[model samples]
Target: MQVVKQLNPLIFLAPLAMLSLPLGAPNSITQSLALLLLAPIAFIATKSAIKKPIFITILIGTLLVSLFQVALNPNKEYSVYQAIRSALPFYLLCAIVVSYKKILARIIAFEDRTPGSVQKLFDRAVRVFATLSFIQTTTFFLGFSLANALSQSENDRVMIFQTTSIVLVFFYSIIRRNFINIFLTSIVIIGTGSKAIFVATLLLTFFAAYSRPKFSMLLKIVGGTLILGGTLFYFNPLVIERLAEFAINSDGEKFKDATREYEIEQAKETLLENPATTVLGAGFAMQVSHGVPSLDPAWEENSKYDIENGYWGALVKLGFFFTMLFALSIAKGLPRDEFLMAILLVQSVMFMKTSYQLFAYMDGVCMLLWSICMVAINKINANRNSHQSQFQQSIQR
Candidate 1:
């Protein structure tokens, strides 16, 4: 019984650890199957945790939207299997986060009793994972073809794992005020060559510093940002070039105006052709099958569907009403802390470019953030309660 109790935390950590596995470690199908299998265990473990009404509402809303889509678009080339494949990871991740709430409290209580142990464990794990990722990234940059040796899919998987590790370490360092960890993790994140992650990290660091607003914290933030910028500028100039290219393309230039005009025209035609789909979306499988048309010929050639924006993708998959409800649910579920709000804002921006909500790896990072925030809140409340108890005892004496 004691051993079983001890292992309960692992139920929550298993999916996260699985997510951190290198691309060569497991194929995508196997990794996905592993997460699916873990979902049931998570559900079973978290059965005792209190369920939030907002979460239930979101889950119900998702189901209703899916059902309505299926019912209304019977003639559309929709696949129930494909929809489940796309949606299950999200639902399972939700369950894991909800269930881990209780387990996290317990872990925190244990950490309070054993000072530095939890931090040490996390630091060791992060250092090991981040080191491996750094090595891989450096090898790739040195023209070793290590990353290219793997298939494109595998390479993407590896990068996702590395990115996830960097995010985890980054947040952990922020909470613990571990500068060394922060410096090392930032290097790995920049090495990934993802402009979005770079921007997200910077945003998170700024918000974290702003939350406290101490002079020292401000100095560290400035110093860290400069170091990151200088390192990237010297070693990986392409990141800056790509970001500049994106900014130029996104500006209200003639090309952008033309592209926007063409997209709007195509969208109007689609809505007119399928009026009902305008309300509840054309469903994922259908949307994928009949690709969303794009004004940019290059974009269309690159991707089957040119719905690069996550909000637009949500509208395509769930329609306006359901998308609104989903957004509301997320808003209601998030913590009120400014730091957390900043993280969510960063995540929201990334979601615009890609469907981060549906990806298990990104979801895991979110869950980690949620857990950290909840634990910090709990600690604060506990301290307050302790102070109250001491004051009451003094008054009685």
Candidate 2:
């Protein structure tokens, strides 16, 4: 452990390199190894490590919630072991990789000695985040395009478009304060043809425009709305036809509406029927006869969807206690920045439509999002206090 700790910081980015490598690696194993490898770097970077109360509370609450579910699960097979199967992997990975103790203090201390030095630290942070976001978005697009050129698997194409769209939206939101980055991301997101990403991006644009009380902001909002709205209106068949059809006829739409409504209704019914299980959940995989269900089982995998999406899924699987803990953790720790808020909203919505509970799936993105918000908030508060103190001293003098 000590030897690993003593190694170079460059080693920390080794996993990131695999991300850019030709798609030869087993993506899951590579991501897991990368995070495990980077944990030490995170530990070293974490200085003055204090187990914050909120973090501790969240941890405890989640555990209690899981236990509660175990107790309430009416299914004879439901047990604590199954709960572990569902929630432990992602939560553990997040806990290990994500912390601010080492990185923020070092960067802020080094960046500025003056009253407003925190601003420099923030700018530096933004640059680092923006660069990584660009790289990830670009790599996903490259992979998608390559796959599309070689074969026409609808699954591959959809995955490519979805990945590109979500990352582009998040990246754009992160740098909403930067016009050039935002503009570039906007173009890429449009190219991706994902309704979720498009809607999320537009929400972000509207938020950025309204965050400041200036005519320029209003004009950008109006101009951006025109271009984005018009482009989708014109060229994107998916947007103009499918999305519009779904939007107007959500209750009667064929694919999306049917799927969404079926899942939602089933989940609600399940909760209602098993009131006792509502707190902790029916104990993961209650829908299945055993741990593994056959691919072409009579009861489709869609039964899982009936329980809820990500957040609700967490509640059902981990119990209400843990879900609330996770929610409180976010509320307490994340900053009030417009960009941060937008990303959080987007993530929350995404999780509703799809499962993002896999360890490798959520760890990197969630960690980065949490770190950015916490660090930015710390800088903002520190600067605000310093300014107030200086003003008071001047008055005294």
Candidate 3:
């Protein structure tokens, strides 16, 4: 164990964290290979006391959910196998981030500093985070481009990535005051053709700008109004058409009609037909029978759309209880408003379409959430100690 620890410590783990990039590119062999490389790093980095409780709780919860799903699933062999494969890496990554002492210390140091130091540290942190965000987003888009170039398919990767990119852009906008990056990011987000993301990004930007008193009220109002108006006018019809067609039919709609209404109606029926399934859910791999094709269906399928909505998809697979727990985990894990808002926007975008690829994986977003939690926990600990020290001094006096 000592030899293992020495061979695979924080320095070795850094690259694994780096490799957890956002690109949803199709490379099964590469992903497996990367996992092999990260396994040792994961082992070494995940060795801290503070993170142990968090890791244990999440692991236990996940295991319980998986165990229940396996027992209930009619096709247990395949479902259990796939669930473990998909979930274990996320668990390891969470543990690795939590146990990494040096990273934790640095974050605690930054958070416990004076105001001027905090500002400087914040700037440096923002720059680093923004760079990481940029790398992930760029790699994802490039992967999509490469895949499409090879396969001759023009379909975008998914909606959530676009929304995540917008969130990152919003953060960068706050720090750099570089509207060009924001503008470019806005364009890339729009390129995905996700209506929810487009609207969420607009609102996110407006609120972000409004949060600060530096901008005049009038500028904030005007800027916000313009964003709202542009999105409503430009993106509305296309998104409405796409979504409407997606809801009712098993295939995506060819043209815009009242497809969304029909799809919602169908989803309601599906839910009503399976009341028992509602509480505990249909099981992990139940979607294969829900009419969504293994390959992309030409038409919209209601169940297919659910996969795109992270909140609902989890509910359908893991049960209502687990879904609620996971949601709470996300909330507890996010410390800052900006981070929470970013994730919320991504979730909203996810809810608006059929994008399994986007919301399914735990990647950079999970890492960020864990980091935020570490900082929050560290800060709380520091404040408690400070208060205790003051009390002791007063008693001595």
Highest lDDT: which candidate? 1
Model 2: weakest 10-residue lDDT segment is: 147-156
Report lDDT per candidate.
0.55, 0.47, 0.46
Relative to the true structure, candidate 3 has a C-alpha RMSD (angstroms) of: 7.9
* Runs off by more than 4 Å, candidate 2: 1-85, 88-107, 110-180, 231-235, 250-256, 269-276, 283-308, 357-360, 367-397
> Candidate 1: TM-score?
0.74
In candidate 3, which residue ranges exceed 4 Å CA deviation? 1-58, 72-81, 89-106, 110-163, 216-289, 294-306, 352-359, 363-397
Q: Write the per-residue lDDT of candidate 3 for residues 145-258, one digit (tens) a residue.
A: 322110112444233322353455454454346555455454445444555555566566656565554656447445744764476447434444444544444455443334
Model 3 poorest ten-residue lDDT run: 144-153
lDDT ranking of the models: 1, 2, 3
Clashing pairs in 1: none
| TM-score of every prediction relative to native | 0.74, 0.65, 0.58
Which scores better on lDDT, 2 or 3?
A: 2
lDDT-better candidate, 1 vs 3: 1
Task: Report per-prediction Cα RMSD to one decimal.
Answer: 5.4, 6.4, 7.9
TM-score pick, better of 1 and 2: 1
Winner by TM-score between candidate 3 and candidate 2: 2
Residue-level lDDT of model 2, residues 2-107, one tens digit each, is: 5443233223333432333334334344344544655655455333222666555545655664455545556544434334444445454334323443444444
